[model samples]
Every structure is written in structure tokens, then in C-alpha cells.
Target: MPDPSLMEQLRADLTTARKDRDKLRTTTLSTFLSEVKNREIEQGRAVSDDDVRGLLTTAIKRRREASEQMRAGSRAELAEKEDQEAALLQAYLPPALGEDEVVAMIRDAVAGGASDVGGVMKAVMPHTRGRFDGKELNRLVREALAG
Candidate 1:
């Protein structure tokens, strides 16, 4: 048999989560898999691993935002739930770039004559794509440029 794709691995993990009675993992993986399938159907092509990763990243970001909003509204329990879900989803994402790594990339871009915010951002994003958050990268670039 062919090696399982990342999506298949995720499905297998979902099954394991179900067997282990991990409600949060099971629910999050199931929902994410559903969205992946929906996107495949809409696009009429097999979704690549990168596409699935993009979807997972978006889901995690939404959960983070929801958690923040819930906390701001004093809904601690809901906020915790959102945080848990986000963490579960994050398990499937590629490891994020470390702070030092991001800073190094920013420094390289700045040294390469990307002095302005937009120029540095444009130079750094292609290198950081799918590995770091844009807002975080933007902040780091601004700091590097300012300092």
C-alpha cells in the first residue's frame, strides 16, 4: 500500500482519538477533516498537504481570536475551551519559527537593503511563509528596522 498522506494520517489520528475517548481531539480533527473535504469538493482537486496546513492554520487563528474575545467578555470557561481546541489543532501544524530564527531572518532582510517596513516585510514573508504568523513577523521587522 502507498504511504498515507497527511490527510490520511489525520484521519487515522481522529480514529485513535475516538478510541481513546478524547472528545476535544476527536471533535477538532473531525471538523477539520470535514472542512478539508469540503474544500476539495469545491475546488474539484485533491487537496495537497500545504493546502490542508493552510486550513489548519486558519482554524487555529480563528480559535485564538475566539478565545481572546471570550476572555474579554468574561466567559472564562468558553475561552478555555477555545484555547484547548486551538492547541489541539496546532498539533498538526508545522512547528512555528522560533523568535531568534525570525529575528535572524528579519536582520538578513534588513541587511539586504530592505530598510522600510513594507520592503522588509515583502522580503521576509516569502522566507517565513507557512512557518510564522504575519503579524508577529511584522512586529519583529518593525523592531529590527527601528533599532
Candidate 2:
């Protein structure tokens, strides 16, 4: 059989998590699924894999921030739970590009006539979006231009 789409895979995993009574995984999946549903309704169409990935990325970022805040507040247990949820959701994203790989891409863009940060970013963002964090990618692009 053909592989299921990311949405289908996520739903199937949610079912499995529920069956196994894995509380963390179940809560993470349920919350993500709701976000997916909300995005679908907002856009008035089914989400593509890329759209789903974006939503997953946003959810993971939120969890990361919450985890940090919890830690700062001395809620280690809550912080740990947030970290766990973030890690669980992170599994659904595409593998992140390595630093060297992203640098090579930046070099190529620069060599191809992108002399400024804005231009280099415009050239590279399409290829790297969702694969790397925006701030890190910007730093790489700026470093490339500055070098």
C-alpha cells in the first residue's frame, strides 16, 4: 500500500497512543490535531503536508517557550512535561538540515548574485523554510554575506 499522508499518519499515531494509554503522547497529539483542524477551517480547504509541518513547527516552538518559562518559574516537573510534549511533536517534522549543509546552500546563493541579507534570504528561504529555524538561517545568511 502507498504511504499515508502526514495527517493520516498523525491520526493513526494518536489512536495508537490512546490505545497504549501514553498520557504525554496522547495529549500532544490531541492538541496538535486540534490545531490542524483549526487551520483547515481557517483556510477553507484541507491542509497539504507542508501546511501540516508548519503547524507542527509552531506547536513545537510554543512548547519550547513554555518549557523555558516553566523552568524559570521553578516548575521543573511542568517544564519537563512541556519538553516531552515538544519532543513528541517534533517527531512529525522533516529532518533538520545540518549546519554545514545550510552553509553550503548559503554559499551557493551568495555565489549566484545574492550580495545582501534580503536578497540572500529571499533566495534561500524557499529551500530552507521549515527545515531550519528562521533566526538561525538569517544568521547564516548574514555571516555568509559578511565574510
Candidate 3:
């Protein structure tokens, strides 16, 4: 009747991946699940969906960096595999904000008197954190302040 939590969704998808014999999906989901479990154990409390989203974002970032490194090292096959894993992890994240949407948010932040880069970033990061790249957000905020 209700949508499952991210943790629950990952667990269910992990089971499905196992059943479907999708090794990449199975491995990715299991590693992500293990990170979620580790955090819960470390904190002695269950993570909220936001916490899971943070983990997903971190995992995806790691995968993307690894992909880049592999590509630079000329390991084409490994790079391709890492890219695949990154794409797989990307699916679990909330859809990214478009340029227009981000610009609108930046405008609102600036209008709210976050006229400096640091101020604008502090104002907007909470809203954009897991769904947006910090570098891109910072650039947008700078653009808003300038124009």
C-alpha cells in the first residue's frame, strides 16, 4: 500500500538481482546494503531515507571517480565496467535537478540575501545536497551573484 523505504527497496532489488542472475546488480546492491547496515550498526539507530540517499550519492561518486581513473589508466574494459557500475548506482539516486530548476533556486537564495558565494551555498546545499553536485551548485550560485 505504501512505497518502501530506500533500504527496503535495495534489499528487495538485491533479491531480485540474485534471482535474475544479474551479477553486476547483485554485487552493487549488496555492497550498498552492507554500507547501510554498517552505518546503522555504528550509529545504533536506523538510517532515514535521507541517510540512505547520502550513502547512495557517495557510492555513485566513488564509482564515477573510479571510472575516470580506470579510463585514464587506459584500462578500457575496467573503465567500461566501472562506468556500468556507476550508471547502475545512479538509478537509485533522486533525479538530478535541471539547470533551470537549479538557477531558480539560486535566484531565490540570492533574493533571500545570500548574495555571497558562501552564503548562497549554505542556504542552498540543504535543498540540493544529494540531488546536485556541490561544484555545479557553487558555480550556479556564483553566476547568480554575478548576473
* Global lDDT scores for all candidate models: 0.88, 0.90, 0.87
Candidate 3 regions off by >4 Å?
A: none
| Model 1 agreement with the true structure over 62-146: per-residue lDDT tens digits | 9999999999999999999999998888877778889899898888888898879999888887767667998998888878877
Candidates in order, TM-scores: namely 0.85, 0.95, 0.94
Candidate 2 residue lDDT tens string, 45-137:
999999998888888889999999999999999999999998888888888889898999999988999889999899888787777888999
Best by TM-score: 2
| Whole-structure CA lDDT of model 3 | 0.87
Residue 109: error of model 3 in Å? 0.6
Candidate 1 Cα errors over 4 Å, as ranges: 1-4, 113-115
**Decreasing TM-score order of the candidates:** 2, 3, 1
Better of 1 and 2 by lDDT: 2
- Supply the global lDDT for candidate 1: 0.88
TM-score for candidate 3, please give it.
0.94
Q: Which residue pairs show collisions in model 3? A: none
